[model samples]
Target: MTERHHILSDNAAALSDDAYDSDGFLIEEDGDDTSRPRLYDGDQLEREERAALRRVAGLSTELEDVTEVEYRQLRLERVVLASVWSEGTLEDAENSLRELAALAETAGALVLEGVVQRRQKPDTATYLGKGKAEELRDIVIAEGADTVICDTELAPSQRRALEDVVKVKVIDRTALILDIFAQHAKSREGKAQVELAQLQYLLPRLRGWGESMSRQAGGQAAGGQGMGSRGPGETKIELDRRRINSRIAKLRRDISGMKTHRETKRGSRRANAIPSVAIAGYTNAGKSSLLNRLTGAGVLVQNQLFATLDPTVRRSETPEGREFTLADTVGFVRQLPHQLVEAFRSTLEEVADSDLLLHVVDGSHPDPEGQISAVRAVLADVDAADVKEVIVVNKADIADPEVLDRIRRHEKHSIAVSARTGEGIEELRQLIAEELPQPDIDVDVLVPYDRGDLVSRLHEEGEVLASEHVGNGTRVTAKVNADLAAELAAYRA
Candidate 1:
């Protein structure tokens, strides 16, 4: 009890007071009160729209009796966070729990209390040891919490055991994250990917009990006196599993079609030789803010974790007039579920196929390095590790100077910038331009007036160094990829 009290006090003190503004959003640093443009207003409108759809407390209760298997939806209201500190220092354990608390809050849970148990390893059956589970039950009861969210992904058996001990719904880190994705997914492809991930996570954890779950026919055919029940059948649980498997297969097919569409679009970009830059970072690390700043993307910029699940691609131009596509991707997190990674593989392909990656890090976070490592782990999983990367340490205005210095000193090709105040943004832009793949062939060409479209292509797919309208045609000097240069070979000046 004393240790629990200590843990609570430490975590309470560690919580950020200034992370949110009065409206419960990441403090908007854009600084204008009355002069916001239409795009900025659209960003605000998007956030308000999400706010309107937030889950209401007490509305998510499941049936009292476990008659059949149900999707393990997060009952997020009034949750007590629990963790097993099997390894890492007390500080590390505390940090992990604190992160879990944030995750719960983002999922619209009111965190009532957080507790950690010291163990060499998590208990196989209950996650927390049996006695510790009882202690957790006491904490849940004392706090009147409706749910317990474990800090790790629990096995199905472990979740059931913990629920039996605590007498409340128990969810794990994976489910909590999945819930966030479910809430934030907007695009058709995004929704399908999230559903696939949820089903994958739900399949093994499905549970049922008693005669209600038995769908096998028991009638005259089975030497029983019944007429309505005589039929070929499987157990209810098996039927449910079959249905889920069917849905999974359908989702895969639908996603495959969407992937083809996406690939076609990507192929068009490739055909034009336009470079791509992907913004990749930890959840709520200001990736969207950076995108809005860089490209005027007008994406919803909420402070919550996984606030933006759909990848947004916007056309942007370098300071030197080279055009490219900048994509804001779904943010990464510590222990991002493998199910999501597998489901979102097509989406993540944007990162893998990009010419450059702007690896954004929240410079203000306590463990910026950890965030970087987690993001890189996901990137590696998607085979995006070899992409040229520029570490953009964002939120420089509020970041600790020491932390900023540490990150800059440690990571090569890193630049510290505040996406809000525009501090160091030009430097970041210059860095990005330098890191982006440059066109190899330089061409000076003169084309007839009828070939104006070629001049347009020269400006779009290549870096136009000089251009002029001649009496007979358009004269252009540019650096371009080999494919574009070959097209202009006939008109070489």
Candidate 2:
């Protein structure tokens, strides 16, 4: 079934006093009130609070099972969202929840209902307070929600406690995001990295079957059939742990190999003096759309979050025909899962290694500024902080004029453009051309007729404006990078 989310009005009220059952499981408020758990009204919260909650209640998208080595899609889960509004205004909290709703949608869940409670800090045990959790449970029950998605990452104990109370599966922001990555990963290396990250996350969360699972029951008496399996008969959980560890190692090895290949390609580009630019931003900020706009890359462009996982690099040139490469990389998000960061490090290096970064932001988003900060936070993690940036405020056709003004006021070098309509593309291109690193030297040189290779090298490694077939050789006038300028020094005219 197609995925859909329900955004409640901002004025909806919270659950009334009589909404709970004797056992405290949520059930529908209007249904027969038996001793059994009541179904949550699914709209217990006030219109405003409910509006703050972008509950993805109806649609179900397939999810990948992280526990398995092979990629497998699990049944879509029905999820309810819960968030704590400790800091920021109600609008801010609502926006955060809205993003969460999008994430849940991306993970293939029908968001049922969302709730938020005002708290200074999350409870150390339940994330939500005990009372709030019960209320959440009530809502989950009422809606028949199979899963509860928290706005923040939950500690293992916290997660366990929440599950015990809600009687449903619980996942935090990190896991939801990692699941999305696993779903979108397409390439061999991308899959390997995602799996490694999943295992790393799963290793610590693995539940053993008590002390019996920890004890070694080796030898023929224990039904050990293999030569090496005699001394250490592993329990089911132990075997799973071992297998995951082994897979992690192999994945690292595979990723390292892929990294070496990437480096080789980067080296070749460097040798040719091709300038590289990388596009990065918050998830679903239109990075792929922008890349397609600039290069006609025809990459996948979807309305969903994290629609593109693998990096795409295509050769593109400026209006002056200065050749450079444009790479579209995985988008960042607020509190990006650390495991993903480490696993995708090699891929993100494309951004760090670029001569310029086209930081795209959805000017039309409710909080474009927040998106900027989140993307920068991840970029800092990847050590791309020092890379020159040109903030591209995309979606101008639909963006709020006030928001665009706010962006332009604070970001002096920012440009507003609509990637969909091609508006302001020329100005964006010109800005990119101007921001890109320029050649170190411009000179007129005449190469000997016999050494045509040098003339060709000049074209490859420099920006040649004019070349002529002179009596002795080809006369070339061009702007050359420092490396090539040195090589052309002897031929300078």
- Go through the candidates in order and give the clash count of each: 0, 28
lDDT of each: 0.82, 0.83
TM-score of 1: 0.82
Residue 369 error, candidate 2, Å = 0.4
RMSD of each: 15.0, 9.4
Lowest-scoring 10 consecutive residues by lDDT in candidate 1?
A: 49-58
Clashing pairs in 1: none
Per-residue CA lDDT of model 1 for 39-152, tens digit only, reads 323123232221111111222223344442132324438888887766666567767778888888888777767777665578899987787788788878987789999989
Q: Give the least accurate 10-residue stretch of model 2, judged by summed lDDT.
A: 45-54
Give the backbone clash total of model 1: 0
Candidate 2 Cα deviation (angstroms), residue 467: 5.4
Candidate 1 regions exceeding 4 Å error are 1-4, 7-76, 220-225, 228-232, 464-477
Q: Name model 2 segments beyond 4 Å from true.
A: 1-75, 211-236, 450-453, 456-469
* TM-score for each of the candidates: 0.82, 0.81
